[model samples]
Target chain A: MWAIQLFNGLSYSSILLLVALGLSITFGLMNVINMAHGEFLMIGAYMVYVTQHLFQQYAPAAWFDSYYIFALFVSFTVAFFLGMLLEMGLVKFLYRRPLDSLLATWGVGMMLQQAAKMIFGAPNVAVTSPSWLEGGLQLTSVVVLPYKRLFILALVIVCLLSLYIYLYRTAAGRSMRAVMQNRDMAGCLGISTRKVDRITFAIGSGIAGLAGSALALIGPIGSSLGTYYIVDAFMVVVLGGVGKLAGVVFGAVTIGVLNVFFESWLSASIAKVIVFVIVIAFLQWRPRGFVSLKTRALES
Target chain B: MKQGLGTINRESQFKWIVYMLILGMMLLAPLFLSDFRLMLLAKYVSFAIVAIGLALIWGYTGILSLGHGVFFGLGAYGMAMYLKLEASGGKLPDFMVWSGQNELPWFWMPFSSFFLTLLLIVIVPMGIAYGLGFLTFRNRIQGVQFTILTQALVLIVVTLLIGQQAFTGGSNGITGFKTILGYSLSDPTVKRVLYWITIGVLALLFALAYWMTKSRFKRVLLAIRDGENRLRFIGYNPAVFKAFIFAVSAGFAGIAGALFVLHVGIISPSMMGIVPSIEMVLWVAIGGRNSLSGAVLGALLINYAKTTFSEAYPSLWLFLLGGLFVISVILLPRGFMGLMKDGMQKIKKRRKREDANENNIDFTFGESKR
Candidate 1:
């Protein structure tokens, strides 16, 4: 029972980690909070639903099941470009004012939500899982690890690995980190700080898109799906500490475990309240968050 | 120096005139409007009370609460419990009986008395605000962090209210109230009385907030907004001040919520969720966060526009609202009041320039004659 619960917690954590990474990165690097980041996830989920319909109408029988793979790439690309557009059009102006940025992005989020409602209608639509992921791995009569959960875990690992490579092994990534650390020094060294910001924001948004696609595999897609997960995603980021990759991972795990544990002991709604209360209390204890980086800069 | 003093006196006189004009309009509204419209106006007036509280914290203290709906809802619930009990005539409320609750919950006992209910309406929200402020502000949590914490608080309160169906009437919330202190709620006279009561409360609270803003305490709030660390160095506790102002703001929201329930006739969990909470902030944002009158005006104007727009073109209202938010943040950061202030300054400058030009022309003409 405990083993299965742990698996359930880890699966939940993967989705949280995927969603929060983008928010944490952008907030830490640019000091801008994108309230519309969840909308990007919604956009990605819609892409999956769209792709499913398209494949059903036009694709050959053998190629139909492979539509999920194509949907993943499409989700990332669409969200990446949209993120770039938002960064250039709106975020560029409010980089210095985090609170204003929050409100403006919220406006953007509202518009996006309205647009999604108009296009997809208000009701939730389901995407059928591929036949390959139809069943679970049975460890015992009472213990069955769903293939869907395993697939999501694997997807998150792959995303984390690629993000590590992009942020560490590449020159552009180095410039991005340099800008994050000290914008003036990075600019003086001839790095285009604007370009770095644009790239970083786009990448973060794209990751959210991937999270959306993963989420679509687990549940029905709706216009307001992003709204449901957004607070939880934000909690993960805050609990983990912003800007630190490890912090996000640890935070997600902690929230996920606590959530499952509490749900097991109490009713679901009560468990949710308990989780939020704990996070708030935890914040009171360590306002900077777990694994927070000590910095010489006063404002940070 | 004399001219400057004269201009200041004139400005003060102009401000009083504007205040009186608005006050007169509110007082005379029922004379012109139908009963239905008057009731609607009363609802908007209640919202103005909440906006005033928002202005104190967001505009002056620079603390943004994204979950003010929680405090508002608490006040509404306090009033609602009393109304429901009165309607039930000493029996279990219909929903509670349906939920198989044979007895009244212990929390519902205090609200049976109208006087206690009224007091609790303000006290409960203020107490919660103080507790939340104590927890976050003492730890020096500010900015986006504080905002998120408040949102979490909203999530907790809303879920608990919904989940405890037997106690809170579930998602439908506490409703079906027939009377208030034995007066029939459906009676037009009662409604008119309530409307006048709303207006009185708004005027009294508005004056109180105005006076508070002009006091030395306002300077400390401003200082905290500008430089908390500097204020701390000069020997002041920013946390206590922030917490006190936050509690005071919650008290105002509580009053607004009670008045809102009295006018609107129902309070639901959906009303106090994240969306409505954030919308409360937008009212202050659009009205002019720094000005008290602007906050009231914002609550009235935005809500009126929302009703009219959504009524006429339901599909387009969200788009317009979204666009207004973006535009207000980008171009109207100081809001409508700030724009008016700028326009007044421009007119004064243009008049001065014209006078200087006339003087120069007169001097040239005299030189030519000589």
Candidate 2:
């Protein structure tokens, strides 16, 4: 039972990690709040749903087994481009005004949710996973690992590895890192900081979109699906400590484990309340989050 | 100096005229308007009360609390508990009985007294806000952390209230209120009385908040918002002020919640959730977050628009509200009142520019347009 629970927790942590990565990258790099980050996830889920419908109507019977793969790419591209457009149109101007940016993004979130309702109707929309992704790996009578969750876990690892390489090894990634460290200084060093911000935000948003596609495989998609996961996603980012990838990993695992364990012991609602209370108290203890940024000036 | 005094006097007079006009309308509204409209106006009045609290915190102190619904809920629950007890004829509330609770909970027992209930309705939420504010503010959790913490607070309170089925009515919430101090709540006369009382309470609170804005304390709050470090260097602890205002704002929200229960005949966790709390922010944002009058006016205007739009074209309501949220922050950050204030200031400035070519008349707070 404990082993199964641990597996469940780890899978949950994958989703948390996926959500947090996008938020942390954007927030750390730009110091701008994307209150509509969850909306990007929502859009991604809708993207998958739309792709599945279109494929079923137009594609061959043999293609049904791999429709989700096409959906995944489509989700990422649509969300990536939308993120770029939003960054250029609105977020770029409000980069210096964090509070206004938050409110504006929240407005965008509202509009997106409303649009979702208008287009898809208010009911929860979902798509079935491919036959290859169905069922679970039965290691033992009591230790069954679901293939869907395992696929998600594998996706998380792949995304994390790619992110690590892109952030640490790639030229653009290093320049983005320079911008994250200090915008003016990075600009003085001849890096195009605005381009860096736009790329970072787009990448971050695309990751959220990918996470949403993964989420659609596991559950229903709705206009307000993003709203449900958003608070928890934010909790992961904040608790993990912004700007640090390791901190996100640490935070997600801790929160995911605690959530599953608490849900097992108590009711789900009570567990949620307890988790929130713990996070709030933890915040009091470490206002700079689990791992404080080395730059003391920004902490203030 | 004489011109400065003259402008101050003129401004005060202008403010008094506005207050009297509102007060007169409040007093005579029931006589002129239909019962349904009077009831609607009462709800808006209660919302205005919440906006005043919001303006105090977000506007004056620059502390935007996203979980104010928790405070409002506390007050509402407190009032609802009292009303439930009264409705149950001193027995267990209906939900408790249905949930197999035989005895009244210890917490619900004290609410038997109307005065005690009223006192708790204000103080309990304030107490909660004080406790939370002390930890958050003393730790210097300002900006986004503070906002997120408040949102977390709302979620915690909402889930707790919804989870404890026997206690908090479990999503159905504490409702079916029948009377207030032996007066039938459904009675039209009683509702009219409640409406006037709500308007009176709001006006009184507005006056008090307005006084606070004009006081030395307001300057300190602005200073804290602009430069907390500089204020701290001046040998003042900013946490105390923040805590005090947070508690005060919570108290105001509590009062509004209680008034809301009286008007709406229900108190549910729904009113204290993330959406409702965000709606409070929108009210102040639309009113002009920087002005108390703007806050009240914004609440009335938005609620009126909401009801009108919902009744007419329900499909367009969210779109309009969403647009308001985006536009208010982006292009119209100061809101309607702010725009009017700017326009008024510009007109005043232009007039004074002409006067500069004549008598060079410009002085005091009201004359800053020049």
Candidate 3:
């Protein structure tokens, strides 16, 4: 029983980590709070829904189950382009003002949510998981691990590994890291800070999209789905320490474990409240969070 | 220097007259407005009170709380509990009975008294704000970190409220009050009285806020906003000051919440969630954060606009509200009041220039005579 609970906690943490990564990345890079980050995730989920419909209508019967792969890519690409467009049109101007960016992005988020409501109607739209994801890996009579969760875990691992390579191995990643370390110094070294910011923000948004795509497999997608997850995602980013991947992982794991542990004894909402209190209490001790990078930049 | 002081005095005098005129108009609004319109105005005025508190903290102190609705809700809930208990008349609230709560919870015991409820309305939110502000500020948490923490606080409070259905009426929240202090709530006369009481409280708080802004404390707040480290170096504890102002702000919000409950006749968890909390901030942001009058005007105008817009074009309202947020932040960072101030300053500057040109000629004559 404990093993199953632990697995469930870990599985939940993986989803949280995915959602937090995008927000942490953009926030770390630009000091801009994109309140619309969640909307991008929603867009991604809707894309999956769109893909599922297209596959049913156009694709061969045998190929229907394979549409999940195409949906993930489509969601990521669409969200990425939209993020880039938003960066250029709205977020770029508010780069210097973090608070203003938060409000503006929130406005953008509201508009997106309203737009989604108009397009998809108010009720939650269902997207069925592929047949291969059905059933569980039966370990014991009392404990059976779901295949869908295992798939999600695998997907998360793949995302993290690829992200790790992208950040550490690539030249663009090097430039991105330099900017994150010190924007002025990076700009002085002839790196285009503007381009880095746009790409980084878009990538973060795309990550959110991917998370949303994964989410569609688990349950129905609604206009408010993004909002429901956004706060929790933000909590992960904050508690893990902003701008640090390791911090996000640590935050997610801690929250997921604590949430599950408390949930076993209490109601879900009460458990969530407990987790929030713990996060706030933890911040009282470590205001900079668990993995704050030492830098000379006073404002940062 | 003497002329500058003279102009400042005259400008302040003009401002007071305008304040009085606005107050007079509000007092006389019942004559022209129907009962429903009067109720709406009262609701907006209560919001204005919340905006006033927001202006003090966000505008003056440079601390933005995204969970102010938590404090507002606390106040509203306090009032609602008292009213709810009174309505029940020695028995448990209807929801409590329905939920199979045999006895009133320990927390609900104190709210049985009307006076205690009123006191709690101010004190409870103030206490929470002080505790929260002290914890975060003492830890040197500011800016986005502080904002995120407050947002989390809202989430916690909302979750807790929703979870305790037996105690808090769950997501439905505390409502269905038929009377207040033995008076029928449905009576138009009672509503008019409540409206008057609300305005009176608002005016008193507004005066207190104005006085605080004009005091030496305002300079300290501005200094903290500009340079907290420097202020600390100068021997002033920024945390204490920040926490105190935050507490005061929460107190104002609490009062506003109580007033809001009276007018709206409902105190639900949804009203104090993340969206409503942020919307409260929006009022301050759009009105002009630094000025009390601007904050009050912002709350009134934006809420009025919200009601009208949503009623007229429900689908497009969010788009317009969103556009307002973007436009206000990007184009009018200082808000409508900021724009108005700039225009006023420009006219004043032109007048000063003409006055200076005349003085220059006179000075030249004096030099020649000497």
Instruction: Tell me the whole-model lDDT of each prediction, alpha carbons only.
Output: 0.88, 0.87, 0.90
- 1 or 2, greater by lDDT: 1
lDDT of 1 by residue, B1-370 (tens): 5665788899999999988888888887888888878878998999999999999999998998988999999999999999999999999999998989999999999999999999999999999999889888888878887887788788778988898999998899888889998999989889888888899999999999999999999999999888888898999999999999999999999999999999888999999998889888899999999999889999999999988888899987767777888999899998998898889977876665586588753322233332
The first chain of model 1 has a TM-score of 0.97
DockQ of each candidate relative to the true complex? 0.65, 0.60, 0.70
Which regions of candidate 1 deviate over 4 angstroms?
B356-370
Tens-digit lDDT track of model 3 for B1-370 = 5666888899989999999999999988888899999999999999999999999999898898898999999999999999898888888899999999999899999999989898999999999999989988998878877788788789889989998899999999999998999999989999999999999999999999999999999999998888898899899999999999999999999999999999899999999999899999999999999899999999999999999988999888878888889889999999889999999987876676686688763322233332
Q: Per-residue lDDT for A193-298 in model 2, tens only?
A: 9899999999999998998899999999998878777777778877877777888898788888888889898987888877877877897888767875677463
> What's model 3's lDDT at B162?
93
Worst 10 residues of 1 chain A by lDDT: A291-300
Chain B: TM-scores of all predictions? 0.95, 0.95, 0.96
Clashing pairs for predicted structure model 2, backbone only? none
Give the residue spans of candidate 3 off by over 4 A: B355-370
Give the alpha carbon lDDT tens digit for every residue of A1-300 in model 3. Answer: 789889989988988888888898888888777899889889999999999999999999899999999999999999999999999999999887787789899999999999999999999998988899899999989889889888878888888888889889999999999999988899999999999999998999999899999888888999878887788878887788865678888988898888888898798888987898798799888887878878765656
The residue-level lDDT of candidate 2 at A282 comes to: 90
Let me know the TM-score candidate 3 reaches against the reference structure. Answer: 0.97
Per-model TM values vs. the true structure: 0.96, 0.96, 0.97
